[model samples]
Target: MSKKPFFLSIILFTIFLFLKGNLLAEETVKITLLYTNDIHGRMYPYENSIIAPETEKIGGFEYLSTLVHKEKQENPGRVILFDGGDIAQGTLYSNLTYGISMIDLMNKTGYDFSVIGNHDFDWGKEKLGHMISKAHFTFLSSNLVTKEQGEFIAGTRPYALKNIEDIRIGIIGLACTDTTVFGPESNISNYYIFSGEETLKFYIPILKEIHKADLIIVLSHLGYEEDVKLVSKVPGIDIIIGAHTHKVIEKPVLKDKTIIVQAGNYLAYLGKLEIEIDKSTKKIINHKGELITILNSQIEPDKEVKYILDKYREKYEAFGDTIIGETSTVLTKIPYKECTLGNLIADSIKITAGVDIGLINSGGLRDNIPVGPVTMEKIYRVYPFENMLISLDLSGKDIMEIIEQSFSGFHAILQVSGLKVKYDSSKPKNQRVIEIMVNNKPLDPKKIYRVATADFLALGGDGYNGFKKGKNLQNVMLIRDAIIKYFQEHSPVSGKIEGRLENSGKEK
Candidate 1:
């Protein structure tokens, strides 16, 4: 071959290479975002309360693992997975290991990063440290900090900068500041959490300027409304994956310059967001999101994740399955109102403590008992907390204050025994409690009465401070133990809505 022709051929090949590189750079990039929030330690499948037929159950790490793996397989390197905290402390399996089991499962579930939720701190900072140490994914939180030093918890960073498919993505992490108010005193005392707006204000600049992030995704554990508020205050975010409210946002909400979506809670649904980013502007030009209800009937459980789940299950399932008692009526939890289940729990405490009154927060009571044999696992689902009983002497006036707090709309309304509480929902918060009759006698301010409640209330959990003024304080037995003992003695028991808590007024 002639030298001129060879050199000409070489120049044409170099031009082709340059053109191809530029064309690839200008082309749009597609990325699939997979997210779950507030798994709440649902290691196994259970009846889907929302879905019909009572037995069309959903959720479980096994089915979740299969769905997620399939998505990753379909998309390859374009898929990014994340969680929105609260991996532990809801079910028996999670409580067995104080969240380490869920962490272990998430490690296999292929999480990229997550933000801490209030419940994630329920076991306290020490146990949270263990979760952090065990998580294979990055823990990101811009707001969670030590009370004294104002530093992010060890093993957690303010945010993570990831380069996926040549796109620089920044994920800002924020936890619910209300954790300080709702979480247990011991768990919250060591840390101060910041609101999402302030945290985003501080970290957005760093991500934009320092890391040069092309896309900013906020993994927010703040409730849905709060996420909207944060977006209003600060701009520049492209996406927000939110949790904490357990609000099933079926569609992504588009605000100013961002889109917000939450998967709901308890591993019931996985949120998927498909977006096409402009190669030049680096903005999400097209996007669609949906919540995939994790129905075990539809998909085969991933074997690897199922093996891990089984390992944890075998360790705890045997004892959790022990039949404790039976219920003739369904003990349901009607939120923010007096419930039959609450009455049973409150009655258990009252009878166990031999006190004049027994009370439990409706917020503390979760799930309902079916009309059949009640197992230890069912009881754990209802009362998952480790709250112990506290016997305290309170003046009728102090007792009045506690009743007022229950209707104050801060926490769930109180469940009561030995007292008939009449409340008007239309009235203002503190004034909602219209009348209280102790043992059918009108509450007298001067009279002193022994009261039974959880130690969590005495410590001001759920913003209930009236229990703080209680005198003759004595710690009784674990509420869980009292419940079990009640079940053993009172099989085929029924908790009816006996008008212990009567609503005199209607909703405004």
Candidate 2:
């Protein structure tokens, strides 16, 4: 063979190898996004009473850690772990530590990022700031700003950029605007939660054009409906990891071009979102998403995380185990109508405050008290919010207005004691109250009445504006403490609905 021909053949082979390598590098890439939302400080696996029977054990930080490790091992560098906020402030473990346990656990579990949930501020801004500082991962929220300072809360960013396998992924964080209203009024009064749509409008374009993100993922604490509406309106978000609503979305919802995934509250489910991105266009060509139930039997608990939880358990076991009292009947939470639990709580507030009437929002009741030994842990679970009892003086007319406001929204019905309310839901918005009786007598619009309620309502939580207008406002005691006191005085308590709220219209 001629030497020149041999050299030419060698050169051609080398060029072919180089071009093939480049082409291979430009092929489609697969990335996996693992997310959990609204964990609510369920550090230990327990029965999912809302969804499953008492025999079924599901969700816990230890089991979630096992899932996280398995996912990381399977996907390696291609997997990203995130939490959609409200991780703190639910169970006894969280309440004891003020969410320090959750932060420490998430750090150990290797979370990449998280959005700010409204409940994260339940303990107040200082506490939330401390947790943010302690977190190993980044906290992102573009819309939560301080009203007094006119700046973003310290230590949180609008968005984050991560380069995964040569693709730049921008993760934007949008906190729920309802945070200002739903959270502890005193805690968030200095903050302004901007609309999610408005925040996205300002940030999405910046992420795409300026940051040059190949993919945009929003870690949102906004509810499912809000997330859907946001994606529909904004149009640039590629994926949304949602929280706050606690809806178990078994599959990803696709709206326009955006993919929305939410793992239900309390670590009951873990969402896995797999996306195939075309290298040329940098757009998602194919995607698959599903929620994996965190059943304790199927997945082993992570020993390391379990050890930390055990330490916390040892510390708080005394208070958690202390029997508060006993209940003769199951005190259930009825959100739409009056229930035994609501009546009992309302009565407790009334008796404790020595007020003529007591009112509590249906939404404030978090759990039910079983007809057995009532422990402090159970009470904490039932009333987890840090709301205090407030005594206010309001005219009978104001009382009627508050009742009408509560009945305005089907789910906003007020739980009451010392009053009987008959409402026709068929009636128009402001005219729903048919008749209101105080102590079996017709309401006197001109007379002043003493009312007791949670401070949350006194501050106009859940859109109860009438409560904010009361005269001679007095903060009594913590609602939880008052309930505990009531339990002490009335052991073997019986909670029964006594026709306090009468809905005359067709049942919804």
Candidate 3:
């Protein structure tokens, strides 16, 4: 062969290899994950301290819909939308529709997948199935399964595989871990729910080996801390988007090379994550995530979604718009502490049941009752759950146990009425309640007392297991109705943080 020909061929081959290498390096695919959690049917205009620190109202579902649609339009086929759940029960509209309206909105907004939150099962398992049936997107839960064969529950799958461009994305959805405990207990026991770490450990390998997923995303309804703990246990997760704690994770948490992000609750923000994947390595080499504040002022509402909302507003306006009563001052919830709103609601439940003591879970009180017209809508927002009121007859010892659980801090302290409880939280668990006075007298261990609370607590929700000891449990009315009735009977009512609960341990 001629020397010129051999040298020319070598130069051409080097050029060809260089071109191929550059092409492989530039062949990265860009993927955007749009997510929202704990929207809680808060589709209406409301003031949020998160997005706007000022008095301005933030969030309208139409605005969220617009922002989501805009991303889809701008990105074309590279976008996926997921909600961390809690779409079922929050606002009057969502509750009235059995969450079908929210499903309709999600369908229109182009959600790809979502997991079921604990509150989603609030209506009942059957109702959750109905809501799932209505959704245009898939619901995934690796943990919740029928006791038989350990199969994923009906209407939900363990994981979903999507091929976007050259990358195969595998998403494992983990439902709310507290589903059983935060339940209308009778409705949630058939299926077995597992821990996030266990479930993720089982599925991560399947996704990586069998499916050859280029990236793994775990959409979790287990709160932020649990998500971090799960990441610590499960080695292969690329990202975890979580809910249930209603955390405003302003910055994405990177642990063990995995990213975790949660948008604040109540439609305050839409979560957006952008990732660049290397085709050759099939890895997310770079990623950026942010919560887009849904400022109603910035974007035009989606007309179709807005029309649906308007229709509901007009139809239900008469239902919630009627002036139920008035409040002389604002009644906001303060978790694990004595708050005016909790006191007011507890008082209402106590008086309505004609019981000696009233107790309520602080989580049951979602929003604050502002000073002015106390409309049914406001009450609905505050007492979002349809928890029925129940009266129980229990010995003073059982009452003391319940009081101790409140101070133990496993959950928010139970709000109380008609009793003055003093807890030394610094003391050992189950030994916190140092003193209790009922009706200006000390609690009698032998004396049976009448107690009123939402059936949720009576059924052992939020870990208040002491309610199990009570006898003579009788159903009162829907909790919201009791609150409304209280307002009606007392129209110009007011609430203040009266030291009904004294943490003597904290005084020092």
What lDDT tens digits, residue by residue, belong to model 2 across residues 150-217?
Answer: 99878999999998886899999988787424666336767787888899889888988999999999
lDDT of candidate 2 at residue 503, scale 0 to 100:
93
TM-score of 2: 0.93
User: On a 0 to 100 scale, what is the lDDT of residue 61 in model 3?
Assistant: 80
TM-score of model 1 vs. true structure: 0.92
Residue clash pairs of candidate 2: none
**lDDT (C-alpha) at residue 162 in model 1:** 85
Name model 1 segments beyond 4 Å from true: 1-26, 179-182
RMSD of each candidate relative to the true structure: 5.2, 4.6, 4.4
How far out, in Å, is residue 371 in model 3? 0.8
- What does candidate 3 score on TM? 0.93
Choose 1 or 3, whichever is better by lDDT: 3
lDDT of 3 at 450: 100
lDDT of 3 by residue, 1-508 (tens): 5799999999999999999988876788888998899988886878866457666778878888899989989989999998998886888888888888889888888899999888888888778889888888999988888776677767888899999988999999998877534667336677787889888889989999999987899999999989988877779999998999999887788998999999989888899999889888888888888888888777888999898888878878898888999999988898878999999999999999999999998988999888899887788889888889999998998998888888877888899999998788778888888789998899999999999998888888887889988899999899999999999999898888777998877642
**For residues 1-508, could you state the per-residue lDDT of candidate 1 as single tens digits?**
5799999999999999999988875687889999998888888888966653576778888898889889999978889999988778788888879999899888898989988877877777788889999999999888878888878887899999888776899998987787424555346667776777877888889999998999999998888888898777998888999988888889989988789999888888889999988878877789998999998889898899889888987988899999988999998887677788888888999989999999888878878888999998888888887788899988999889889888777667788989998888888878888889998899999999999999888776777777888899898898888889888889889978888888888742
What ranking emerges by TM-score with the best candidate at the front? Answer: 3, 2, 1
